[model samples]
Target chain A: MGEVKHILLAKFKDDVSQEQIDLLIKGYANLVNHVEPMKSFRWGKDVSVENLHQGFTHVFESSFETTEGIATYISHPAHVEFADSFLAQLDKVLVVDYKPTAVEP
Target chain B: MGEVKHILLAKFKDDVSQEQIDLLIKGYANLVNHVEPMKSFRWGKDVSVENLHQGFTHVFESSFETTEGIATYISHPAHVEFADSFLAQLDKVLVVDYKPTAVEP
Candidate 1:
């Protein structure tokens, strides 16, 4: 079975202002607007209205036919630029990059 | 294949103090320490030595026989108490509960 990567999650730094955070997220969204192998890529403000938690600022999902495709995506100049910009405002991030071990039969 | 729930991710509120954040995470970990069907229970400070990102504070992965099991975990009394304390300090959270459409052959 081809590898299927699931989700990418990131958390921003506390010092970053809301406006800067919003701009950083939107700008990165624009950059990844058309990456090959990125089956899906969408992000939004944290939705948890719960008191102590700020939902993850953004969650991006993408799938690739193989692991190599994901590696390339990570290193591509365009992606690096996007990552650099996005990383600037983030203080924390949690990324779980895994290919489904097997598709459900 | 029986339902398979892969991951659970959460983000805490901006105003959360570091001590409180750590306590919240540790407490939740203990609450779910013995739940059946859970394959994993772990949390950590974000790690992305690359500048600008703090990395996700914690990531938890658990497997379940069905979505309902995961739901049960969500509504369990211990979970609620843990969540209440945790949510009390969080500003946002994103929850994605999915069953593997097909386990790989």
Candidate 2:
């Protein structure tokens, strides 16, 4: 199996400003340094105007070498602190992790 | 100004078998050839034991060269037909799109 990819989709609380979200995104980016299992991290704000999004406006994704790596990242103090401190600012969150499979395209 | 990523998370309906889902996934993989704007596609079954997934069991993501490319893909007949055919088998669906941005670790 390929490496596991952890995906997070979030809609910030109504009062959270764009500036705050930007800073939080940077904080997540820095998590790679604090969490040894974090292989790479990337994030962005939703740009699609499709009504299908259901209000989700931001997404963050990280790659881990294995499922154990995912567990380590989840249990890391930095990740826990980040979630504990800012989770209240999120209105909705959708998280899913998957391992890539070969597919012709 | 980086490429836009279109992410999809879904859980199949109670009656949908894994074999059916696999066929649908392969059908999706073929969309890249039918839809000119589709740059690349990847998908996988969810592997997280984290209760945070909220029952979302599969994810498919595709990268587009531009926001316009996304627009084209959305309006393509192949995409529309696929969604119309398989959407009824999805119990829950979450879709999000975002444009990549550089950030330091």
Candidate 3:
């Protein structure tokens, strides 16, 4: 029952517009308000100097307190509905969940 | 300058032993001690419900104060030496850096 990070890496289709993507991102962020178990949402564009991204351009991260929280968020109607529009624009996507473990220096 | 999260997703080759991976992960996390700009490190195995991982099995995240901090980390001798051994065990790897933008509810 530890915290989990749902990390999604996405590559938008070549023809998708920035405006369309922006709107989708806004919709994604708004899910936090609708889904009770989802604690926070953050996202970013790839900025690595290393050319190792394999075409993924964006990263979206969602945090939850436990595995059940993630299960709740994924099955929530709000998330399901939003994912439809979100997936339509993506040419490729990678999603993974992990319980973050701090590494002591 | 904004803070950056350097995210790396890796899939180890089928032949690589779990013992080897454990050692490699230890080396990776220890980079914070050797590299001045790498503030923190954490990692986790994929626990996602969705099968969108594209064969990637683990996530490694490093935090930095700025993009330039990441630049210093990437070029530092400790990181370079570590990455060579790390990459040799991987079948595939994807890396991306991004400035985290919080989405307010």
Candidate 4:
């Protein structure tokens, strides 16, 4: 299997309710409900943890079959609409992109 | 255990070597060799994938026992030094801190 092409790890604005968070989770997934070229996807809020991993609020990991696939997703109206709706509520944003070299199994 | 107060999730500079990534992973954990009131920490680089997670670079999750504990960690020299060393290499940084309301089993 090929490595995922893009990953968007994010955190919502403080004071956000679980209900709102859940809505966002589903909304993003629903946007590109069945776009091809994507291989994997997942979203999560920061969970209660015992140690070392306490501060993170949410993480959304998605993978594409190729860079072209990612570009398509970015331009797709559904994806754009989702981004516009979800990101509008965020305060701090950090986005990073990478192409993996080696695979660990 | 108290919920960790601070969380610093990050991605390193693109083209960063695996060796460098490993150094960062161990370094952060080593910095607080044995601090109290803090509970968690973990680091990882973007991994190869087949679909949605293709472009992201790396993620580091760190949590503290209390807001104060995190504040202390931030001011602590060892932690400071470690942060200085590692953050110096990061290009894009996304830090988020959240207190859990409902614990999930």
> What digit string (tens of lDDT, one per residue) describes model 2 on residues B1-105?
358999988889999988998889988889988999897888988888767788988899999988899888888999999988778889988788888776964
Query: Tens-digit lDDT track for model 3 on B1-105?
Result: 568999999999999999999889999999999999898899999988888988889999899999999999989999999999999999999999999998654
Ten residues in a row with the worst lDDT in model 4 chain A? A96-105
Residue A55: error of model 4 in Å? 6.0
**Residue A75's lDDT in candidate 2:** 89
Q: Write the per-residue lDDT of candidate 4 for residues B1-105, one digit (tens) a residue.
A: 656424354557877788997877777766556566456655445543333332345655556666677667667778778878888877755554554333221
Ranking by DockQ: 3, 2, 4, 1
Calculate DockQ per candidate and list them.
Answer: 0.07, 0.70, 0.80, 0.09
Q: Which candidate is the best by DockQ?
A: 3
Q: Which candidate leads the pack in TM-score?
A: 3
| DockQ for candidate 3 | 0.80
* lDDT over C-alpha atoms for residue B73 of model 4: 69
Candidate 1 chain A, run of 10 with poorest lDDT: A46-55
Overall local distance difference test of candidate 3: 0.91
RMSD, model 1, all Cα superposed?
A: 10.1
Give per-model TM-scores: 0.46, 0.93, 0.95, 0.50
Question: What is the lDDT of every predicted structure here?
Answer: 0.55, 0.86, 0.91, 0.59
Question: Would you list the rank order by TM-score, best first?
Answer: 3, 2, 4, 1
* Over 4 Å off, model 3: none
Worst 10 residues of 1 chain B by lDDT: B46-55
